[model samples]
Target: MNTPCDIPALQLSERSFGLLRSLFEKETGIHLRGEKRHLVIGRLQRRLEQRGLHDFESYCALLQQPHETQERQHLIDALTTHETYFFREPAHFQHLREQALPNLETRPLRIWSAASSSGEEAYSLAMTLADTLGPDGWEVFASDVSACSVWQAIQGLYPQQRLDNMPKGYLKRFCRRGQGVYTGQMLIHADLRARVNFFRHNLLADDNKLGEFAVVFLRNALIYFDATRRGQIIGKVVRHLRPGGYLYLGQSESFSEPLTSLEYLGGSIYRRPSCPAIARST
Candidate 1:
């Protein structure tokens, strides 16, 4: 008579909770707050069932195996990927399309969606840039710590409702409505999908090889990190920004202390001073 919903959730003990959460923080730099205990249990419950593990303690043991890379990624994906949709924040894109690109003298016009979850933000940036830049060469690089999210993003498939916030023009220009057995689904247009590159990257590590970008959208995801880690992440990420480049954060995200690297430009936007201005001021 017990339905799946009626089945009691897997119990996570205080010791196992501390161990698993610490492992998560070490690998991903996200501070799993104590209040997120229920969320963690609910999200990770299936993983335990599928692994044939009876409890959270056993799951924690499996996670400790060095060769369990896929399982490790599953943990990260389950915990870190929050709800994201196309054009979630319109102002940042508007700023890029209307204000930043106009005055920008950079040749390549490279941009990074530093926390692109499921590729929505990156694709949004790509579509906006491709529409504006036309045949001119440009780059939109996006990365996430969640391997599963990276895989989903690379597929570029979504339910049609995901486009609700997308402008009519972009929907026509950048997406193809599904047909046949795939009804109610939409796919990012091949050209638009090709414009945005997706990869798996953890912000806790500095990937200097990605080179410099003219703008980096670190956005709303920073709220998951603690203050010290937030500063460390910002400092490392700023190293990738070209001089005069801009950084956009979520409107809700703010620092506990001043950031000496970038000048705050209001509306949660910050700009790095150009080389000439830096030299002149120095």
Candidate 2:
């Protein structure tokens, strides 16, 4: 089973590619178009090499086995995870600070960062909430489908360059610069890290109950899915946002068909109707 692969010469056959694209779509609701084939190969090349598998076929075999949960996770991580940095979109966080916080009816306020990759968005929200809410009544809960991503987010470590987009004072106040072996990296301050919770959850499924929140940051990731899948994912996500709570999507993302409960506020911000006679599905 362990055929040594020539990493440079490795190729994903058309059959293997089709199987994988379908499998990934079935499991994660992400439609991998033809253009993403190279992206998949590049992302998964390390995984194939690590498994000592000579081809994508062998790797796919490993993933198909029910007992290969960890290996399957590695595949999902490689395909589903996308890199994100601190304050990737400052305006969304600005709206959270300026608008979302002022109209809270709930106690022990919570925010969900859906598809939170590597914790930047969650930690950024944590800092904003800590500054404005004074830490007692609020918490940020972040989840991603990739176990690797969730693990990285939990570690609270990142290269310092990724934080370049970070606002000026936040770096000093909420994080510490790496020294010695970690010179070019930074670690989120322990205090800020503690306020944010990171976990692995797939938006394609809704069995896991994350309590309702005052705001949900479900950004960028939606663009990868087809409209039907997008609707399903958004439908599941909106149920966790309390009526009157806000939802932030990527600036480029929006629904093909509007939900009756969600009212579009500009800048990719949306709010659930404060008075909902019934739950509305997208």
Question: Highest lDDT: which candidate?
Answer: 1
Query: How well does each candidate superpose onto the true structure, as a TM-score?
Result: 0.95, 0.92
The digit string of per-residue lDDT tens for model 1 on 86-150 reads 88779888998898888777878899998898999999989888888884678899999988888
Error of 2 at 36 (Å): 2.2
Q: State residue 146's C-alpha deviation in candidate 1, in Å.
A: 0.3
lDDT of 1: 0.86
Error of 1 at 135 (Å): 3.0
Candidate 1 residue pairs in backbone clash: none
Tens digit of lDDT per residue, candidate 2, span 1-282? Answer: 122464364678899999888888777788889988788888787777777887888888888999988877777887885768888789988888888898885878889999998888899889888888886888889999888899999999899888998888888889899899989989999988888989888898875468788899999998888888887888899889888899999988866767667877789888898887643544
Question: Which portions of model 1 miss their true places by more than 4 Å?
Answer: 1-4, 276-282
Model 1 scores worst on lDDT over the 10 consecutive residues at 273-282
Once fitted onto the true fold, the runs of candidate 2 whose alpha carbons sit more than 4 angstroms away are 1-7, 277-282
Error of 1 at 271 (Å): 0.6
